[model samples]
Target: MKFVDEASIKVEAGDGGNGCVSFRRERAIPFGGPDGGDGGDGGSVFAVADPNLNTLADFRFTRVFRAQRGDNGSGANCRGASGHDVDIPMPLGSMLFDIATSEKIGELTRSGQRIKIAQGGFHGLGNVRFKSSTNRAPRRASPGSPGEQRELRVELSLMADVGLLGLPNAGKSTLLAAVSAARPKIADYPFTTLYPQPGVVAVGPFKSFVMVDVPGLIEGAAEGAGLGIRFLKHLSRTRLLLHLVDLMPPDQAPLAQQIRTIQDELRAFSSEVAQREQWLVFNKCDLIPADEIEAVVAAVLGDLDWHGRHFVISAVTRAGCEALCAQAMRWIESQAPRSEQDLMDDEISAAAAAAPDAEAGDEDHRPA
Candidate 1:
């Protein structure tokens, strides 16, 4: 399936049913009172996250969604049935936004998580509700309110533990294939991998992490160059970044200069992403003579003033790939948990902390 990261959709909630204003007409009863039943509430619209889905292509064809209207109220105290709610299945990690106000509704980060996009209209009142001592035979009934309608912008951000970054033909896909089971297209020409591909890299039994490989970036990528920065959002949730560089390339630019170009583009795209912890991985080390490898690595590191961890690997030969994977797993494990459990706990704590303030506000508003 063609990966679609963004899409626009229209959602309409069901409208409430109209109330009835009828009086009971029983046999031998001269003063039959009002016994009209109330109308049922309308159905709402919600967006649910589906783990099996990874793209928004399904929403492209079906751009509009409308729920069922509520049933009308009946006489003799017979209530109407409510309308059924509508559930929209969207990919996990999808963010919803209001197109008119550009307000962020919420993001679906967990499987089966749901967020309400539109609310149903309230039910109309019946004549019985308005009946009082003076107005025993009330004839007026309020009409049902209209449902909420909204146009939403859906954007998907991939969830991964590690992200790959580099220029074209830098052996990123090769490294991914060597370390994991993902088989992205490999070619000598640039732009072979047109989209982002995620793979699971297992360091050992019961120890693994997800890694995502996006299309290689180039100079002026932030300014809509080759492939642009469209796919970069896939890395927004990643904890670590692995920057791949070809040890030997056809271009005459220095290795340090090549690295700097990618860095500038990354910073241009997202400053927060540029602040992520990155490790330099020089690929195709087998092409360089063994004795000159150390000197070349040293020169590039010194020229770039890099102080972080670096690795020399041959992706085609699977050399040094194991160590890289192991280190990545360890680093990911060392970081703070980004799981749903922690998020839920934080929310609970926040709500608990706010309970006292709510009580205090109630006390302040109490009758004196």
Candidate 2:
């Protein structure tokens, strides 16, 4: 199925059945009384989070949803049956918003979670309800109340252990294919992957984490350039971000400059996401001269002033993958119990100890 993460729809609750104004007629009875029954309440509309659903494609073609209407009341004092409630299934991590008011209705963060969006109409009264002492006989009956309706927007954010981010053709998809079973489309050109593709990477027999390959980002992405920030929201739920940078970009832009571009976009998109644990993975190392690999990694590291963990790997040759996977697994495991600030502090300490004399930025170059 084509992946659809966002959708807009209209939801309406069912209207209540109309009331009846009938009178009872009995044999051998001198006088008969009102015997009309009340109408049944209408069904409500609800949204449920389903773990099995990964996309919002169901709402793509269908934009309107309505519950069943209640049955009308009958004579002889018989109340009609209530309509069955309707449950709209949506993917986990879906957020609902009111389109008219721009207010957040609620969020479905877990499977089986449900929220009511529209309320059912009230049951109407019958003539029997009006037969009081003041009036020996009454013929008036109340009509059913109308149901509620709403226009809603649903947005989905993927949940992943790691999110891959970089410029176009930066080898994110290649790395994902090398590490996991996901076979996302790949090409020699930029923007080969347009959507977010998630795969499970196994570092141990029973240990693994989910990795999401996000589409490439260019400058002005946060302000609606290129594919825009629509796809960026998918990375909001990631535990960590893996920034893949090509060792040598064909554009000939300084590798540091490319890294800076992506970092700036992340910061512009969301500060909270920008602050997530991010690791630099200098990809396509095989393309670099074998003798210059260490020098290039060190130079890029110096330029980035990177404090977090990093890796150098060739996704095509699968070189350095095992080590990268192992280290990532270890880091993921170790950080499960630590706070975000602690992790940052530890990374800073490591960077300071590793390159005590290396100044990341100076008068000659700007911050990467």
Candidate 3:
């Protein structure tokens, strides 16, 4: 199935039923008061997260969704039945927004998570509700209000543990294929990957991580120059980013310059994303002699002033891939969940640190 990450849709909730007005008549009784029933409430619209679905293709053609309308009230004190609610199955990690106002509606990050998109209209009041001792046999009946309607925009961001970042033909697809079972299109030309592809890399039984490969970026990608601009948001959810650089390139661009180009584009797109935890991986090492690999790595790191983790590997030959994967697994495992007490301690420490500065500022503002 073709992967669709974004879609526009319209949702409407059901309308409430109207109230009824009637009078009771019998041979034995001389007069009977109003005997009308109130209308039932309308149904609402909801969006449900489905873990089995990864694409928004289901909503591509069907753009409108509506819930069932409520039944009308009847005489003889018969209340109308409520309308049935409607559920929209959406892919996990879906974020919904109001297209008209550009306001965020909600997000579905976990499986079976649901959020209400539109509220149903309120039911009308019956004539019996307005009855009073002073004025009996009232003939008034209220009409139901209209339902809520909205135009929504839904976007999907894949949930992955690690993400790959690089320029076109940087051996990102090659590296992913070597480590995992994902078979992204591999070729000698650039831009082989057009979409985001995810794969599972397992270090041991019941121990594994999900890695995602997105389309390569270009110098002007942040300005919508390449496909990466469209898919870069997919990496926002990842915990780690692997920046792959090609050791041997068809073009004679400086290795450091190539890396800088991607860095500039990333910062331009999102500074927060650029500041994320990233590791450098120099690929295609088999092309260079074993003795010279260290010198090349050192020079590149020196030129870029890189201080984080670095790795040398040949995706084609699978050399140094195991060590990289193992280290990645260990690092991922190290990011354990913090306890509630730890969070509370951190908050207290932050507040205490701020109190002194706040007092010093107040003293400066005070009159002598």
Question: Model 1: number of clashes?
Answer: 0
For 1-368, candidate 2 gives per-residue lDDT tens digits of 76788999999998888788988888987578888898989999999999999999989889999988878888999987887789999988899999999999899987899899999988888889888888757888887888889999999888888899999998999999999999999876666577789999998889999899988999999999999998899889898888998988888999888999998999999999999988889889888788998898888889889888889899999998888878778878887888899889999999988673455435337554
lDDT of 2: 0.88
**Whole-model lDDT values for every prediction:** 0.90, 0.88, 0.89
Sorted by lDDT, highest first, which candidate order results? 1, 3, 2
Instruction: Give the CA lDDT, 0 to 100, for residue 290 in model 2.
Output: 87
Runs off by more than 4 Å, candidate 1: 338-368
Candidate closer to the true structure by lDDT (higher is better), 2 or 3: 3
The worst-scoring run of ten residues by lDDT in candidate 1 lies at 186-195
Q: What does each candidate score in C-alpha RMSD? A: 10.6, 11.2, 7.2
Model 1 has an lDDT value of 0.90
Residue 82 in model 2: lDDT: 82
Residue 217 C-alpha lDDT in model 3: 88
